[model samples]
Target: MKIGGLIKFTLIDFPGRPAAVIFTQGCNFRCRYCHNPELVYPHLFTEPVPQEEIFSFLQRRQGTLEGVVISGGEPTLQEGLIPFTADIKKMGYAVKLDTNGARPDVLAELLDKKLLDYIAMDLKAPLDKYSLITSVDTPPEILMKSMQLIRQSGVAYEFRTTYDKEVLTDADIQALEKLTDKEHYRVQECLPVAKEKAALKVLHKEI
Candidate 1:
């Protein structure tokens, strides 16, 4: 629970439920279009938010908030994540995890314990192009294992991709269809920022 940031409350994070957002610091990947760059790169990390403060706030909002969203720098990266999620479940709050699907083991453990109510796993690329999008050395097989676990878990989940010029294209979208079942897929328009935004605008104009 190395909490780097906290959104006291959020209405849109968890589907159909108001919840608090717990942002864990330090991501494994570094996407250039990433809006939350601070959370990804430790060089940009901010002061750590006390876990007690976060729990106290959740305690106060217990009745009002329906769930909690564990998002990151990769929530699964935190060693304290499982126990922390269990604590939230103890409070009778549903938990939703936003992840990159790198750690199927942790995800499976949480699912087995009923610690996660929902999951939204990001599909960085169409298997072959993951490294290009994530700016990391990711094995496509590792992510596929996670996807398989998610599909077999019988939990509510969606696989999503963020579209950006350097990553996806019309052809790539069609290519992605062959990578995974369409029933579990979603394509999100990339909302860029700073230099990335400028790059995307140029790409949009060209399109």
Candidate 2:
């Protein structure tokens, strides 16, 4: 895993469980309101926290922490993700993945292996407006495929959107709502670009 950084612990990230967060390096989307630019931009990439260092910490926290959240710069982008997650699963820690749903193939593999206990996927915009919000030519069908996989995987999950009224309108949000079961949808307020990445993973609020 090309880890960008980690939060030693957090109460808000993994639903109902105390957990540590691993932020991976590199993202497919460049949302205008992104808070962790350092993780996204190649120019801002830092030396990865050694994989051994990360596992050592997890090994120590094994009994205390109930889960581990693999967040991003898009977690599915990592070539080492499956094994990395499998290693965590071996520690008897429940795993949660936060992703943009761009790689259904990878998500499918993880689900098939029962590597993830929870999933939080960001729904950037209604299918037609994804490019406007993510600043990339994201295929609507690609996003749809991921959503389908997440919903059918029988994994506990939520589809969330960052709420920045200026960037996403009420109409747009409603349109996005139409795309998912409201019981599993949420909205989070987007924060400004931060110099520090700690505690950025706030609990999601109902839409």
Candidate 3:
């Protein structure tokens, strides 16, 4: 995997555990309010984080850190993810994957192999507004399939949306309810990064 960034430790990223977060580069979705804009836009790809260095840090923190969170522009997009995560698993660390859920086959394989401990899939928008929110041409059909796969996968998972008012509205929420069973969804307040603070505050008020 081409690791774009590595957070040595995080308290909130992986539920209760202190974990390392590996941010992979490149994404299929170009969400306008994406805080990690560098990850999504390849033109700005940062130098890859040295894998050996990351592994060494993980090894040192083995007893202290309980888990590792593999997040990305889209972690599943990287073909090396399985083997890379497999290595982490061997180091006796629980693994959690944060994905866009576009690749069901990869998700299935990882779960089947018991390589992942938890999964977090993002709902970019209401079904119909996917392309609009992503700022890219997205196939609603494929996204629907991914949603179904996750629901039925029986893995510990959460379906979350970063509710941004500029891209999502009440009508979009209704459309989301129609597309997905609302019982499985979680809506979160969009946290403002330094660059996105003003816009996020205004949208927070609207929400």
Between 1 and 2, whose lDDT is larger?
2
Give the per-residue lDDT digits (tens) of candidate 2, residues 1-207.
888778877899999999998889999999888888778999988777799988999999988999999998999999999999999999999999999999999999999999999999999988877887789998877889899999998999999999877767999888889889899999887765563344333411100
TM-score, one value per model: 0.90, 0.93, 0.87
Tell me how candidate 3 scores on lDDT. 0.80
How does residue 200 of candidate 2 score in lDDT? 39
Candidate 1 residue-wise lDDT, 95-152, digit = tens: 9999999888899899889888889999877787888888888888889888888888
Please state the error at residue 127 of candidate 3 in Å.
1.1
How far in Å is the alpha carbon of 101 misplaced in model 3? 1.3
Model with the higher TM-score, candidate 1 or 3: 1
User: With candidate 2 superimposed using the best TM-score fit, by how many Å does residue 23's alpha carbon deviate from the native?
Assistant: 0.4
| Better TM-score candidate (1, 2) | 2
Write down the RMSD of all candidates, one decimal each: 6.3, 4.7, 5.7
lDDT per model, in order? 0.82, 0.87, 0.80
Residue 115 displacement in candidate 3 (angstroms): 1.1
| Model 3 CA lDDT for position 173 | 69
- Model 3 Cα shift for residue 23 (angstroms): 0.3
TM-score of 3: 0.87
Model 3, 5-124: lDDT tens digits are: 777778988877889888898998877778776677788776777789779989999999999999988999998888999999999999999998888878878887889887888988
